[model samples]
Target: MAATVVQLTESKKQIQHTHQVFDTQKQAFRNNPMPSLLERKENLNRLKRALLANKDRLVDAIDRDFTCRSKDESLIAEIMPSIQGINYTLKHLSGWMKPSKRHVSILFQPASNKVSYQPKGVVGVIVPWNYPLYLAVGPLVASLAAGNRTMIKMSEFTPHTSALFKEIIDSIFAEDLVSVITGEADVAADFSERPFDHLLFTGSTSVGKLVMSAAARNLTPVTLELGGKSPAIISPDVPMADAAERIAFGKAFNAGQTCVAPDYVLCPTDRIQAFVDDFRARFTEMYPGLKDNNDYTAIINERQYERLQSYLEDALAKGAELIELNTANENMKDSTRKLPLTLVLNTTPDMKVMQDEIFGPILPVVGYNSLDEAIHYINDRARPLALYFFGYDKDQQQHVVNNTHSGGMCINDSLMHVAQDDLPFGGVGDSGMGHYHGKEGFLTFSHHRAIFAKQKFNSGKLVYAPYGKAVHKLVYKLFIR
Candidate 1:
């Protein structure tokens, strides 16, 4: 094992430049204001065009960064979703922008109440490296739809992808409307210090806390998309092979780097061995030639690879058994940080793999005596970003959904809940804060402005004049239920 080191570099001049950039944008937003409905629609269309036009370049950047991200995955998750989100907002932005009516008291006869939608001005978006483009551009799409100028801070981990995305954004949008800031973690910390109307961050829980504290300095509201040890529960009634295939597809996708990927599996004790056997076979079927498969991704960097290695080593040292899907083949140790697709059996709560998020192709199979035990195990951990259940029984599925709270859940599947435009996507508790995607994304970036209007007639003179018994009686008769 190698020593792990995480370094972030940002200069003072860069920090000053970022502050000035955002300040200028804030001023522009206040003076010129965001475009009207027709103009906003045109802007959205332009953004869609840019994303569609540059799909190949964007996908190539992701592949260079992750080593195995499929073009199809990038198109579906990053390009298409962003375009679809804009279209969804375009179809409904008019209704969403309309002032909501409120009931007025009869005593205040000429007075009326309504709530207007207002932009929060100059929103700051801090994106993670895992889903570099999606995390960066998706939030920007929503912010633009809500009529707010946005500034994005791309993670420094994926330098190539970050630089490419910055170039793409700079070419299409103005600095005042949309700007990209790319550097390192120090830049992120400094960016968080600068006052902004709102901040949205997607990363780890520990980093998410720091971001929250920084936002608290200016009392700026924050929307956090953090990670958790998301769990997958396989019911006894389901077909073992089908469940294993779906789980394998999600767990090994991008080498399990997704924030919402199933970190572990909860299954009945009686079927533990059978489940592992089926899972191993399914993984092989999905990605043949485990050592040299292009579809299988290498770990992000040496740091992450070593961190996962430490977790596996610690778990193995503690007597947990490791079952490799390709046990007969030699380990791909010579490659650039390639971790074998493996599972941990006899896992206990205290094991490091069980305690922390397994952000690699390592799955811990924890057997439970009963369904109650399975639900309790999930509830005991911090609410995860996503929960997956494989069961055909509607009542059983609902039972799991209703009993536990997660950012999202999928029935008989894994990682599919995010595809729905109607459902809100986010986390609860330590997992994450605030929701986004589709309408939820629009609302997250919008500010509802409550307005009260009154006619020239000051009909409330009776109550203002005196607080006597006659006025009190009138107030009671009109206001009391």
Candidate 2:
């Protein structure tokens, strides 16, 4: 399939369509309202059933796009996690939606304070291709639960999967409530220009900036889920084999296409060989048949595949040692767009591979003599979306966690930290900004209105009438700080 490009242009017809969709949905949302807790629970249950029923189709579509999406990986990584999020939201929505009570000061004893949670009218979600199903539904669940209507724009790179997803969602919900828009980049660019109460985008940092700029025209609040070069630090205390296994699984999952996937690993010089050996063994054991393996995903498109190829070639030319966990045999090469699960060693800061986010199955193993060096190396770059530390020591873990800031952290593991529905998922600085999932997701689409209710009272009126000297002292004592 050829890449479809769409350039957004200003036209009366286009603007009218955008406004019509927005206003229609906004009205539906305002009148029908978000479901009651029972309704939400029922809808979630329905969604879970739909996923269960369409699991094979969904997996197949992802495989078609990636060339190798593992069934178990898809179930665990996308389907189950989404179901878990839905269950979490269903279980907690009532409490999350309830009005919060606030304290009234002695001077305002006659008044009561409270906060009401109101939904943001419309939400726009721009999803990425790497993990299309999970990213699309994750934010959709949050937006729906928060009583907001959603318009989801799927990535153009994976058009097949995007079309399939649109079909699935269109079958499930009314277009006015939860609609899917599938087109080229121009459609997305135009969609981003539409007026929305809140916008959540998950993609590259460059695209995130464009989304933000487009959204700014309408003063729409946005949550940018952009990617950065996330680092995984292997501590000396942890067994090299065990650390490698965890890190390898994360980096290899979805062909290391995850936004939070470990882009590079920081390990002590001595343990590099041990880590490499363990990773190789695990990669073979995990997917015994590489070529026809439906478990590993392909790079989303030819451009990305070529981009990764370029990075590998550049790293090799720059004198970085490339070790593949699984080599492309005749069977593998003929049937799949299988990329070698590789580790690059002796990578210097000057190298091109080290300069950007790999976003592929290439893992650069940078050696450091000490933990301080590792920490310093990671801190010097733009803070990532996630910081992964694998160690058992309490103090060392705390030191790393406290001294560095990322969108989130995983101690002794990678990527799994994001599965915790209780934790807020987001990024910091260049990694991205704003948070969602669980209560944070609810709050992300909610407006908290502070309310102060008062009854007719006599004591507060002293300063309002006659301007007396004694009343000034009392008023000053009550309010002046």
Candidate 3:
């Protein structure tokens, strides 16, 4: 009972701290409503230097958090993207900040119109655990570029990385400009309820709904990067080797904990076995052995491990066939939460693996008779965050592109669309809403305020306070048609 009381006391303290930091940021943003271009560039450069200086420490922290996360995977998936995203933003920020001139109609003489992008005050970023560094820094880069004060709420599931990240952020930024808050789920709920000017959340769909609901109380605009069953399709004529290799890399990277990972594959009915064989071969080549292998990453935690295991068990009990890709046949009963890349065949709509976002190294291959059938199958479900189609035919590619609805697409590839610095990243419908990355990221955190300038001329007044004036009739006659 005493321990419970102490825990509650600590929670209260954390909540109070979060509120204090938020208020400080709000006031700071009020003081410096818009940062100069050079100041924004300097902030980006400072973030880049900090990331490069502590790259190894960040990798090690993530590894400790996940127990068996590969160092290369962390470097590739988390650190590299964060640094690269900053570079991309720094290169394009000046152009993005310039006021956009709009055309004035002939009816409005001696008038000039343009749009000025202004920062939306304090922004709240709720980072997910899968790729904590990249998710936190990705939104932070955009928010800072737009001259907004930011407060990030890191995931409790990745405690080590979260704490280390908070330390790093504190070293470089004052709490009023950028702050990192770390705590458990209740703390996250409290943080979400704060009245941030804009909030960006990266997590599951269910949690996203709750975050949106909380933000609604303050009428805070949100950019939710949620996840669903992102699908990959294998064209009938495409070579199985090519499709399987790319899909293998997509699903195997970071143990398929990526939001944009290929959740399932839709292959020609005749090539189901062939695609499975090739996928298994390619995955094994990537990691010859799962046990004692440094390249293959393990599941994040025990709870996630059991969740994936239960998915397999439930699928099997419901008459689904399981093909374990344990090439070395190593015993995995030990403490390492490593799970082999398993393939579930004969998946149905009711199975857990088919129904939920399989955020692990579990790939379910569903066979379709024709290309139309595959497209229809995807259309029937909630639109995914990403859709991958493998085929060289231009007509077939365009056909799929025109018919399908998703946040992003990759023709003849998978997962690479997200790495491109020029493309916008987001989802559609049940998958998610709002776009970020590239120009979209800057616009998402900015309010495009339109400005009209008229000097020595009051043309609008000619039609004012008069029902049937000659100038008003002329104005209507000239433009009404």
Q: Which scores higher on TM-score, 1 or 3?
A: 3
Find the 10 residues in a row with the least total lDDT in model 2: 1-10
Question: Candidate 1: global Cα-lDDT?
Answer: 0.84
- Please provide, for model 3 over 1-481, each residue's C-alpha lDDT reduced to its tens digit, 9 standing for 90 to 100: 9988887888899899999999889889999999999999999999999999999999999999988889998888899889999999999999999999999987787799999999999999999999999999999999999999999999999999999999999999999999999888999999999999999999999999999999999999988899999999999999999999999999999899999999999999999999989998998899999889878888999899999999999999999999999988899879489998899999988999999999998999999999999999999999999999999999999999999999999998889999888899998887788989978999999999999899987887887875788887888898889
TM-score between model 1 and native: 0.95
C-alpha TM-scores of all predictions: 0.95, 0.93, 0.99
State the displacement of the C-alpha of residue 253, model 2, in Å, after optimal TM-score superposition: 0.7
Highest lDDT scorer: 3
Predicted structure 3: clash tally: 0
**Candidate 1, residues 248-274: lDDT per residue as tens digits?**
989988789889888999988899888
Candidate 2 runs further than 4 Å off: 1-19, 32-35, 327-335, 465-468, 478-481
Candidate 2: global Cα-lDDT? 0.84
In model 3, state the lDDT of residue 269: 91
Query: Which residues of candidate 3, in runs, are more than 4 Å off?
Result: 1-3
